[model samples]
Target: MSVTAPAPKRIELSLPALHPEQERILRESSRFNVIRAGRRFGKSTLGRHVLMNAALQMAPVAWVAPTYKRLTPQWREICATLNPVIARRSEEEKHIDLIGHGGEIDFWSCDGGGFPGEGRKYKLIVCDEVAMLGSDLERIWTRSLRPCLTDLQGGAWFLSTSKAASSYFTQMYSWGQGERPEWKSWQMRTADNPYILPSEIAAAKQDLPAAAFLQEFEGDAVSFSGSVFTNLEQAIVDAPLPEQYERWAQQRSWMAPETEFFIGCDWAGAGRRAGGDFTAFVTMAKDGTICAIERFKADFALQRVRLAGLVSRFRPAAVLAEENSIGAPMLSALRASGISVQGWTATNATKHKAVEALALGFEEGRVKIYDVENRAVLLAELMSFEATSLPNGMTRFAAPSGGHDDLVVACFLAYLASHRPRVGECAWSPI
Candidate 1:
């Protein structure tokens, strides 16, 4: 009698239900897929499900993000799906192996001055938020991960909302739009997702500057030429204002006995209703998170009263106000009210250095800001601000003609106060 052989068990694999827009992209047979979608469009959910489906093909796949911190949440979701089929999990390496010859999954970051997953082959690559990868965008693709796909003739998917219109991501998008037959691209807005509220998007359009509204909510990569900031999407968070934690801080202050917050003020010299300049006050956490912003055109007395209200609410340790022109009177007023206020004078050189520092704060991911309604003006000013190199080798930073930088200066002072050096980096010295 001959012995019978058992067949391999069939492992059922199904993709999570996708919205029509997401499903449409996967239906294509293109070797490269690029998607530009607005915030809250469920790009992560779509990416997670697609990667899970790809795992069934028995070939290694990689997921890359701008930073490891941003990759954590998505990694958690992917791990949960692979848990049932996991053969092994390496938390330190962030790799997952499947039991049914489902190959493996790896996660990597584009930062730290190296190509992610160098010398590793993959059957598929997913680069999320390609726009945030910064100046390394060209080198990362041409010299690194793109070559790793040759062994298996693997495919890639790139996704981002677009930062600069001239960004390298834009070049890849052009390739998808008939420049390269092997590539395909699609653009979707917040409204594309049936789940997002139309009212919310409409409100954002009203609040955000025109260019910002287009890029962030409509998936258009509008160029903010010479803008002092990069990676605004990463810096602007949805955290609650400091006032929300007022009670908690009050209770905890007795235990820690340390300062929790600081404030930076830029005076507009009673420009309210006169249309000359606007005043800006920024309340910043000790760690550089901009907890709240108050921008208005008000007289000196009213401004102090408002500033005092903020001081009482957050109980900031100090208020650093610009110590020139109208700023002098504002500082004196706040000081007279028993508020701990300091005055910092801004020369062109010092101001430029401070602005540069704030820019770096955004680039290095050291800064975060609350995305409140009043924040739109500040974002607009930062994005539209220009940088000019002077003959003396000093860089000149200023807002576009007829635009306002009151908030930008306030933010610079806040960042300067937050990162004030006790020993190193005295270029940001405030007098």
Candidate 2:
């Protein structure tokens, strides 16, 4: 008797339920799907659904974010969601193999300056927060990832809130709606999400600047004119420390204990209310190297505890907190914790001095920052800062409407503290 071979076990795959808007966009027959949505409009969730569903059909799918660090959370979620149907997962390569679909979803970062989906055929590609990927986004799509889709006739989806009207994201959105016959687009606000409260949006509108409200909540690409700092990109040390710094620092290991650390603090409002400003702490070395930065929104008392912990870890020579509003209390609280904290009053003159110093640092290549792609808000603030000239010939520096400069201010403080003279330092020149 001849025995027949057993059939392969069927693996059930189901797409996650999506919101009505998400479903509508997915239903579009266009090869390109573009969405310009307000913040909190469920863009990430929709992207997840799109990638997962695509994997069930024709794949390997590709998900691209501005940076690897930003893509990490989504990568974890995708792995967890498809764990049951996953055949293998390569964390090192950020690749996943499905059980029965012959499908894989790989995550890539645009910040690495390489073609993400090169040489690989993809059935679907999702670019989350494409606006933050910078100006070369068009080349990334048309030159790099688009060719990968040719073999499978795969589709591409672009998702982001408006960054600027002149940005590649807005151009793509326009092309998707009109210029491209194979594309479709959708624009929606946070209000469209029934899960969000109307009062919350109203409060946001009131709190945010007019242009910021329009861009962030109204899905408009407002122009960024009169920006103060322009050389942020040139100053960013995206990868490891530069070889020059490494060599010099390695030669100076004899003075490790003498190297003073500085901390700059920007205290958030009390009550730790939702949507409040952040308490940013920037730590730097005496040599003007930014070591680390942390931002939090919590109660003043709680923040002090956190500060104390950081103080012990950093062993800062001096902690400078902005001496305004809740900052005064926070500085005192930190000092009471036996930390060497000081209050730095933020008057117009002092703020102007600090801001100019920071701008000069970036311009002169004296200050260096890391994790530019991951720490987006900080980088954005540094780039979007603007200075206005008053009728009296005075200049006021601040972040554009709807943006926070807490990180920038904290960084400025760190930079300022880095130059302070240490005890037993000579006042006369060595020469």
Candidate number achieving the greatest lDDT relative to the actual structure: 1
* lDDT of each residue in 56-144, candidate 2, tens digit only: 66479999988888889999989988888888999999999987766889999877655566889999999988777656677888899
Tens-digit lDDT string for candidate 1 (68-113): 8988887888887677677898988989998867589999986674
Q: What ranges in model 1 sit over 4 Å off?
A: 225-320, 323-397, 400-431
Model 1, position 363, has a per-residue lDDT of 69
Give the clashing residue pairs of candidate 2, or none. none
In TM-score terms, candidate 1 sits at: 0.58
For each candidate, give its TM-score against the true structure.
Answer: 0.58, 0.54
lDDT of 2 at 248: 37
Off by over 4 Å in 2: 7-14, 224-431
Count residue pairs with overlapping backbones in model 2.
Answer: 0
